[model samples]
Target chain A: MIGFIIERIAFFAAIGGAGYIAFKGFSAIYRNIMLGRKEKLAGNLNTMLLVAFGQKKMFKRPIVAVLHFIFYVAFIVTQIELLEIMIDGAFGTHRFVYHLVEHIAPLRALYVFTVSSIEVLSLMTFFVTIIFFIRRDMLKIPRLSSIDLEGWPNMDAHLILLMEINLILNIFLMNTADMAVSNGAYGLWLSGIFASAFAGWDVEILHILEKVGWWGHLAGVLGFLMYLSISKHLHILLAFPNTYFTRQTPNGYLDNMESVTREVKLMMDPNAAVPESTEDGPVKFGAKDVTDLSWKNLLDAYTCTECGRCTAQCPANLTGKKLSPRTIMMKTRDRLEEVGKNIDANGGIWKDDGKSLIENGYISVEELRACTTCNACVEECPVNISPLNIIMQLRRNLIMEDSNSPAEWNGMFANLENNAAPWQFSQQDRFNWAKEQ
Target chain B: MQVKEMAEYAASGETPEILFWVGCSGSFDQRAQKITRSFVKILNHLNIKFAVLGKEEACTGDPAKRAGNEFVYQMLALQNIEILNGYGVKKIVTTCPHCFNILKNEYPALGGNYEVIHHSTFLQQLINEGKVTMAEGGLFKGKTITYHDSCYLGRANEIYEAPRKVLEQLDAELVEMKSCKTRGLCCGAGGAQMFKEEEHGRIRINEERTQEALNTNATIVAAACPFCNTMITDGVKGKDKQASIKVFDIAELLAAGQGLENIVL
Candidate 1:
């Protein structure tokens, strides 16, 4: 009775600690995302289904896609079993589903089917995680090992893979020991193979081993849940909502600035009402930092899987330019995190610092200028993230607000302003080529 | 030049079937003027009534928008929208993909809406409706002609089939570069890159794209966009293969195949 009370106390303590940490981390992220400007979201259902659930864009790489699909499906399905584990841990019960299985005939069959499937999936998950480890650590695939992924990003990937391997192993070990103790036919296929190794062992020793496996598996999962908020693995939870709010506009289309459009309309129609100017409230053009960007862009930064698919498919990156689309997303998230920390330290207010995302060297002018606006990065993102939009927004701040653009671009801007074309020719001479024909 | 202005057509109480949007390149660049003339020749041969904005046509401000000068883009766009709206123009066709993209995709957001068509798609439609005809055993017949997909036309607007369909109508064998249609590489000239020196890189994007075209070994490389034409032409010259590989716009090819080359001049 004392041992049972100690087990329950330990389980509740673990649950409370992990829950507190996970909640605080998620709330911080939520606060950071709210700092961005408002944007209306539409077509959420289709985008979520096609991109997050269907994994449509990921299939561009067939072999990796199949392996990832198996792992993704297994991860979601295993949560059902995790729920049962939670119930068992709380009640000090073993195999909570056994009670239901004994009462309903179909429930027994369903319980057996689920356990058998998870046994196979657990093995598949182990194998896939091993391959991921090999790909990242051994092969050092360029996308996986790019300079941007050097410190924590690299270690985070390895830790997740290692943890996954450990978690699956413990789960399997627990099931094998359970089947050996119960001498049950359910979950006997794969577990039976391992159960034979323990046939000569005492049943009391097997029960202790099963308890160790059970406690360790639960602890690992709780730790993983808390770690997710800081890890790139946040995509596991954020990808669905991120894809749902993705921009549905045609990739080639650019949004017109309402402020600029109002000026243009005033120019076109002199009779248009000129609204009175109110007290100044940050009348800057385009994005200078995370605060000026749309909330969807902030969501995009958090949802990035650090997959480097965008960087790999970027024409500018492929041509040896300094622009890595992956880096753009990473830098945006980093700046947002810094700003979040600043607001947290202060009394929920932002104090102007002497530094900013551009001038402080988070993203350089060379990186911004190197982009060709090819939309290739946007196209290749599995979750519909648009690093091109972020790059363009930064470029707008560089040009419109700072008047800091490349000399050639300044000349082009002048030509467009004066001659109504990109060339030095006068607008009157626009049709001269047609006259020659 | 026999191009009539919208004002001229309106004074006579006449409404043309379409407005020919002579973009900056089509109106100013010497080489692109030939593409403009070839397209006009096809329209004339089919008796499709069309008028141009002529000297009144301003740039579509696509370069300004792409180069991050939204102020100048809005200025130019608002002016052109006023001119177009004043004429009550309904349909527009252009040989330049840049203009087609801006006019069709960007203009509506600024309250300038109209039916805009790229000349390649327009020519394909003309042929489909039996308004234009191709002659048997034309100059391009039996030749392997590969089509270079312009970035604005291919990926920007999803117009892969229209140009390919037009090329198919010609007796020439239509070949494809490894990166064609939706997967097409840029000719290193979109996003206003044509006006500026390329950023420092290991290789020019057009040179790489050209190498893909050369690998196909097609005798004639057909392009639709004026910017793409210039880039591929320069790329062919860069490779010193201009003597063997010729670059022609789809409209120019159609004009030649339809025995309307004389009308192009």
Candidate 2:
């Protein structure tokens, strides 16, 4: 009875501690995402079904898509087992669903089939994780091993793969030991093969091994939950919402500036009444930092899976320019994290920092100008994230706010303002070609 | 070779069916002027009543808006909007994807809305309506012609079939580049990159795109946008295959296929 009490206390304590940490981590990320300006969201259900559930864009590369789909389905299917494990851990019960199988004959068959399928899927997950590791480390696929992905980003990918492998292995070990002790007919296909090695062992030792496997798997899952808010794995939860609120405008359409439109109206109609600015303070023209971006952009930063598909398909990146769409998303998320920390340190109010997203070298002018704004990056994103939009916003700040656009661009601006064309020709001679014909 | 002004039609209490929005390149660039002439020949042959903004037409401000100069873009857009509104123009057609994109997608927000169509689509409609007919065994007959997808028309506006259908009427084999349609490569000219020197890179985007077209081994590389035409022309020159492979706008091909090659250039 004392041992039972001690085990129960320990299990609940681990659960409580991990739950608290996970909640706090998620709340911090939520606060950071809320810092952006709100925009209307539409087509939520359709987008979620197509992008997140359907995995529509992942199929662009067929082999990887099939492998990833197996892993994704396995993770979801195993969640049913995870719930059982959680209940068993909390109550110190063994095989919490064993009563259902014992009571109903049809349920017994169903339970056996389900457990067998889970075992097969767990093994598939193990192999897929290994393949992912090889692709990242041994093959060093150019997209996966780009220079911008060095340091923590590279380690983060490796760590997640490693965690997945260990989790699947523990699930297998628990099944093997359970079959060894109970001589169970269910879950005995793959587990039976491993159980033979432990057949001669004492039943008590097999029980202890099963308990250790159970505890380790549950603990690892909880740890992974807490780690997600800080890792690129955040995409697992964020991709759904990110894709739902994606901008519905045509890819080529650049939004007009309202201020510029108002000025143009005044220019066209001299007697037009100018509306007073309703803003509480002076309105800044474009984005210079994370705060200026809309909430959808901020959500895009969090939704990035660092898959590098965008960069791989980018014409600018393919041509050896400094612009990497992956790097743009990474830097935005990093800068937002810094700003989030600063706000947290200042008791929930942002304290003016000398450093800003652009000036602090988080994203350089070279990278900004290198973008061709072809929307290829936007099109390639699996979660429908648009890094091109953020790049355009920063470029707007560079040109309008700071007058720091490239010299050639300034000349074009001048030509457009004076000649009403991108060239030096006069508007009076616009039809000269037709006259010559 | 008569191109009436909208003001002339307005003064005569007459309105043309469509307004030809002669973009800057079509109005000024030497190479693009040939495409303009060929399209005009098609319009004349069909006897379709069309007018032009002529001196009143300004740049649609596409380059300015793309280059991040909103003030200048709005200035140009508003000026052109005033002129277009004064003429009470209803429908517009242009040979430039840049102009087509801006007028069709961006102008409505600036209070200048019209039924804007690219010339490729316009010609495709004319052919379907039997207003324009191609000759049997025309100039482009029995030739393999690869169509280059312009970024603005293909991906930006989702127009891929109209140009291909126009090419189809010429009785030519319509070959496709490896990357075409929604996955089409840019000709290194969109986003106002036409006016500025390309940034440092291993190979120009147009050079890469052109190489793809060459790989198809088509005799003619056809394009719809003036920018793509110029870039692919330079790309062909760079490969020293200009003598072997020629670049022509779809309108030019259609004009030639109609035995109006004398009006070309």
- Highest lDDT among the candidates is held by which one? 2
| Per-candidate DockQ vs. reference | 0.67, 0.73
TM-score of model 1 (first chain only):
0.96
Worst 10 residues of 2 chain B by lDDT: B256-265
- Residue A133 in model 2: shift from native, Å? 1.5
Cα deviation at B29, candidate 1, in Å, is 1.5
What would the per-residue lDDT of candidate 1 be over residues A26-56, giving only the tens digit for each residue? 9999999999987777757888999899999
lDDT of 2 at A10: 88
Tens-digit per-residue lDDT, B1-265, candidate 2: 7889899999999989999998999998999999998998889988889998988888999887777778888888888888898888889999999999999999888889899999989998998998877778867667899998887887678888999999899888888888778677778888878888878888988898899999998989999989889999999999999877999999988888887755222
The per-candidate TM-score of the B chain, in the order shown, comes to 0.97, 0.97
**What is the iRMS for every candidate structure?**
1.3, 1.2
Worst 10 residues of 1 chain B by lDDT: B256-265
Best by DockQ: 2
